[model samples]
Target: MSAPSAPPLKLLPLILANAACMMAMNAFIALLAPLARTLALNEWQAGASVTVAGVLWFLLARPWGRLSDRWGRKRVIATGIAGFAAAYLALAAGIHWALLTLPGILAGFLLLLAGRGAIGAFYAAIPAAANAMIADRTPVERRAAAMATLGASSAIGLVLGPSLAGWLVGGGLVLPLYAMAGLAVVALIVAIYGLPGGDAPLAPRDATPVRMRDPRLRMPVVVALVAMGSVAIAQICVGFYAMDRWGLSREHAGRVAGYALTAVGVALIAAQVGVRRLQWPPHVLIRRGAVVAMLGFLVAGFTAAPWQLIASYFVMALGMGLVFPAFSAMAANAVAAHEQGTVAGTVSAAQGIGMVLGPLAGTLLYGIAPAVPFVVGALMLASIAFWVGTAREPAVARPADEAA
Candidate 1:
């Protein structure tokens, strides 16, 4: 007889919850400039507002993952979403008060920072729990597809969040922020009622804890660092590049950036959906995707036209879409079942580091030259592709005890 499979219903809540979380996160991101302007803050302060979240996410992801491992996936995820909703509401209130009756802009800025920090702290739990849950339910052979499904959901949310925010911000910035909070509340409800209550440990309760130094995890972790960093570099530099190269106004450049990012999101969704159906090994996917992305970046660096840049970004996005899910699957497979949360947290922390550094590096490079950041990003990705392509896949330990 065939082995029993995970019910389709079980995965739905995870997908929806992930989508909602990402949507809320990106909505805030989409409104950052406007938020800064409304509060009469400088560019540095505006940047710091967003940076606070990334910094907190980097510091707190591991602890949240470990907590989820001990407590339970559903509970942690639900609680996190609920907290995310509260944070969004708080952030909106901060902005509202700043506009209406705050003593000073600084007071509102501090409240906004606090709210963003809360979001980073609580939002960290969702991805770690969701990824660990996938690890718990999926077998090794099907893990990539499972991870891809989650990735697709996230991509959709990223796309929708900005679009929704852009539309709602026309009515008022506060409206969109509240809408994001509402979405989070809905996600919390779904997570509580729809997700499974119990999580069976991947290994026996007595299994040794997986160390971060495990050979199997090293390559994927490195890849995650480079991939996320490259993405961040590209993201941060694109708008500046558009303005400098195309001689567009800030408003026009912002719109161009949005269109380019939307192309990337569509490409990512398409590529991940396609890759999930294939049975390629993680290394193979990583190598090919990195090469494609590298090529795209190189092309983008040389492109003079707006359309050319957007098209190149789409190619890069397709490659990144494949790389992310493959790396996630490989990392999850590297350890015994019980170590999923740890590995997921580690991966999140790595990506968070990338987010923290990418902007700084990209901006510095952009000051040197318009195309320097893209060229550097391409070089980094090329090196990653070569490294991953040559590295040997480590043997994965089974979840079941050999002595049994």
Candidate 2:
């Protein structure tokens, strides 16, 4: 398959579509804690919703990508979006089963699989496809900037999305979730009319189809998993921790968490600008992110104050912001045109796993000690940083031009 040739300014609609979808996805996430409380679940279970969704997102992303490769991205994306909207509507309306069986897991799987799949495929595939699309259309020398443009769309969407959801949902989980579903519908419309359609991008040639087996991805994937895992774990525990530690009420916790997340969004946007100006190698940027994230976790762990946790999160976000873009850039550079979706989806899968594990790790540690989760999470991220420093990378043909 050849790349889909984009029309003038076609990238704008693609970005707008992606931004809308992501905003909805995250807005719904911001409502998770409240949703759990309303459903009478414990903190752990509340966190589990997100963890479960992330796992679903990470695990199924590639399958969706591969499907898109064959069937066409727009079709797969629209299907995913429709399923996602339905799943949320069901969840919002409250679906509970009295009995546990093969069907119970199956039921839970479908709910999350459909809801999460919309995001996993829609968000993951579009970016990967768009990046490749941008790569195909832009000259190689300027591809990095196009990729940068691609990255910015998501960042800008995310920066304001949660707050928007919270304001819309105000006090109800259903409203926020419905808002996400509505956005998914809107995204589907945008995709149908706004997105470019042409011949599909290339597919895997027979040689080395599935596995790159490259250590370049290994180090970054590890970093992403641990770092994202820590983020996920903290997301689960920190609300309760804030309440317990600072005597904050549920509403206060929600407000504070929203604010902190917004700060994270801001940090990521700052990173986009900062990275454009920096001359650092990708590895260096990742390491810096790891160290900052480690510090944030450690600070949050030791904190006796809510304000400290908030402060620490911003610091961690700054580092993470630096690393995330570089990681994506490196992954894009590592593969051939045919395998872009596969590789990008594979990376997203790792992210999903980290998200799933984050809460599980936290819950396990919570049973032992409340603070244990943060410390362990910090150590996990730190270890990944160390691994990256030592890992022997694959012989990726450094592009004739750097991603500068």
Candidate 3:
């Protein structure tokens, strides 16, 4: 089938809502180390907070996707947005109290963990439903480009979040946290009022459950795990890398980290723009993007100057922007209409698992030596690129419901 003339107008609200949430989340992540210091927590503790939240995200994302299939995308998406707003506010409040009251290290650590865990559990709903909605509307031949539009929303968020946080952080660390909460509120409003209403079409009760190890999904799942795992590790460590490698102060490191992350976001947007124009098949995009990402990591592992480090981050994210949409399109095209929701959820679950492993492993390796993790990450990406290039390309087949 030929692609649609244009995506439906209803996609605007979903795009806006997802962008807002992504901005809030990435902003917080960029400022994690500085925020951890303010709350009297250590590096390990901060990393643990991400690990716990990722655990919840990984465990629940599939179920939430399945729920969206039954409960309707708008309702599930709205609930997720509402929960995101509430959870962010609660986290901000907890941080404020910890700062004022001088909570013990353990108390402060647990507070951040609980707050992040709550946010992750709900935030999983937003992306899964939104992606499934796009899958519902787009045909197989156009799937990658449509998915690229959604990925662009995330890239925009990544761009705005760290840039805004870096600017606001000069006022105070807490200021950025509050700003994130405000974005969530705006997203919640859009999700409630702007998205289409009514139920998603139901699938049969006995539709085969999508599994992580399914033949159709195995390569995509592996790609999600490696790509996201590398990104998470790099993100969680960049601030510390700035401080230690460049000899910047904590505050200065925060600023530098923000700038570096903003570079990543810009590159992501640039690459996705290429994806839209080039319209490469899923296999080609996956293979080429992976090779680019591996080169970026290799540069990052050995760079001697701050400018070089930032450049490497830009290169890395540019490649990721290509890989994400391509893999998502591959997975969606491999599944049936009724299975879109579950597939999207399973993809997210794989990403969550990557998040869970990346930070924990990254931090530990960093403690041993700053460059070790990046070098290892480079090798992992190289391996994946080779694997993708050697594998046979999956045939894109339209589902009966979609063809009709």
TM-score of each: 0.88, 0.82, 0.95
lDDT of 1 by residue, 199-251 (tens): 83534567565555656577777888899888877766666677779887554
lDDT of 2 by residue, 160-225 (tens): 677776576554445666666677678778877876665345564453544535554665466656
Compose the digit string of candidate 3's lDDT tens values, residues 198-265: 54656678777877777778777888889889998888888888888988877888887888888988
- The runs of at least 3 residues in candidate 3 whose Cα sits more than 4 Å from the true structure, single-residue gaps closed, are 1-9, 395-404
Question: All models: lDDT?
Answer: 0.76, 0.62, 0.84
From the highest TM-score down, the ranking of the candidates is: 3, 1, 2
Q: Judged by lDDT against the true structure, how good is candidate 1?
A: 0.76
RMSD to native, candidate 3? 2.4
Q: Is candidate 1 or candidate 3 better by TM-score?
A: 3
Model 3: weakest 10-residue lDDT segment is 395-404
Question: Which scores higher on lDDT, 1 or 2?
Answer: 1
| CA-only RMSD, every prediction | 3.3, 4.9, 2.4
Best by lDDT: 3
